[model samples]
Target: MNAGNTFEVEVRGIRREAETVRSFELWPLGAESAESAESGEAYELPPFEPGAHLDVHVPGDLVRQYSLTNPHERHRYVIGVNRDPASRGGSIRMHDAVTVGSRLTVSAPRNHFPLNEAAVHSVLVAGGIGITPLLAMVRRLCELGRSWDLYYCARTESRAAFLRELRELADTCPDGALHCVFDGVPGTAPLDIRAVLAKHGAQADFYCCGPTPLMDAFTAALADVPPERVHLEYFKAPEISTPANSQAFTVTLARQQKSFVIEPDRSILHVLQEHGVAVMCSCREGVCGTCETAVLAGEPDHRDRVLSPEERAANRTMMICVSRCKGDALTLDI
Candidate 1:
């Protein structure tokens, strides 16, 4: 991630994908100022790798991470959001209230689950709204004339977004490279992993992003293949085994010069936000890096999905959403 390259962007457009999913396009608000200064008109932002995602700050709500669905060379940043009924009201508000002109603060793109370099072929499996990241990969691979196959599975055709474009691309591609499997598709079974693996063998690199059960099924089905060759992007954090009735703890904000006690059942993020402190965050499950804060003092029980062991050891940052303090109190840079 480029430290000085961050930009605050505004929503330029919004498009609905499904009843629960929407796509938003963002552009830098300072583009005109930069261009007027003859600093060279900012071209479309640099291209992100296949699995890159951006952390978007939704203001009153915590920051949230969304997969980039737009092509790399596009002049704007595009992200697809699904209105998760179980969400802590973030997705619901984003889907219902956010408009075309809304200003959303965003972090630069980051890639933790990049594409495999060794494999000559690629197999992308996307379930439901999980198609967002894979769609970007498909666009890039197509532009490069690379060999890849996309298997998109959904409950029905109505719930599937970008079906028309995907089908059109597959038709023009030499072979039938794109396959859509719907549960309602009469004679066809939905995403036959066993058959797919048996036919494709272990030669191609496999990428999957979707619900936990779908990912788990793929992981089990591809047990014969090398684990390193299989990549999975999870939208949520894996269930943790914290003490059933974990005790509450106090977190001190060094910059704000304040401290708050988190309830046994609540997270540190809730406590800080209740005190009117604006902490960066997204994906309360700890999967995304949006809520990461600088740990100025104290040991952190890191529970985020993005940070590596080395990152955790650095002790410079911590995701407060799901992560906890190891001791009585943790001091944050705020």
Candidate 2:
């Protein structure tokens, strides 16, 4: 990791990976550069794992996240971003305001979807821009000489980022295992996730990141596989309609000897923060694991994407941002 939890970096390069996707290369500021403010001197970035991501501070006080596509590049972190029309000024602002020499403050790498090093085989699946983190994992697996294959899908060939690089990597492996599926290509068959997943044994480690529908299909396809062995990273939280049976509940902070009542309209995190409780949070929809809190004594309504079905059943922790107490009163360690 970096020496500090956060640092400032200058954008050094921008490369178009596809029609809408562009890669940003960040060069971390060094001592001399900090003093000069324009010097070319920069320090080697800290090491990051295959699935790690950095929280980037964009122009509108927005802390949007982007996955690091390359971990072995010592001097810079390369992240890909698609110019999303529906973005809340994050990706759009990055595309418009950021260029070579644009300075930005960023958090150190953090990973929730990590690669399992000891697996007998690995299956990497990606959809559109979701290929960023999986590309990093593919690079790591190739470096270790591990057996792995990637199934990448996009709406069209022009929108598929890193195709050339992935093709080259698969070329190094036997039988060229990179599978690309493009829906817009003439006579291209729809990718049957069931057929793709069935080719691999249940013991193989499966990793997927993509649009919600695609991920749901993957989850359904892996019903026979152990849930713990299947890893997923969601760019957006799964949509769940409000439960008509939802009720107001109370949360007790065991360590602080504090209690707060959460109305059905408000989340536990909102109530706690209103009462001056400190909790770091991101993606309030619960996809990111930032607001995960220890559940010391009560059953929590688990709603986060970070936890597995088994972890949810254990009730060890819950994401306070979107989850609530299952019982009348929930006890938290903090």
TM-score for each model: 0.75, 0.89
List per-prediction Cα lDDT, in the order shown: 0.77, 0.85
Candidate 2 local distance difference test against the native: 0.85
The most accurate candidate by TM-score is 2
Candidate 2: pairs in clash: none
Q: What is the lDDT of residue 216 in candidate 2?
A: 90
RMSD to native for every prediction?
Answer: 4.7, 3.5
Q: For candidate 1, lDDT tens digit of each residue in 234-313?
A: 87876657766466778888878888887767898888788777766657777777677889888887777667567788
lDDT of 2 at 65: 82
Clashes of each: 3, 0
Model 1 regions more than 4 Å off: 1-6, 30-39, 42-47, 184-188, 243-279, 291-304, 307-334
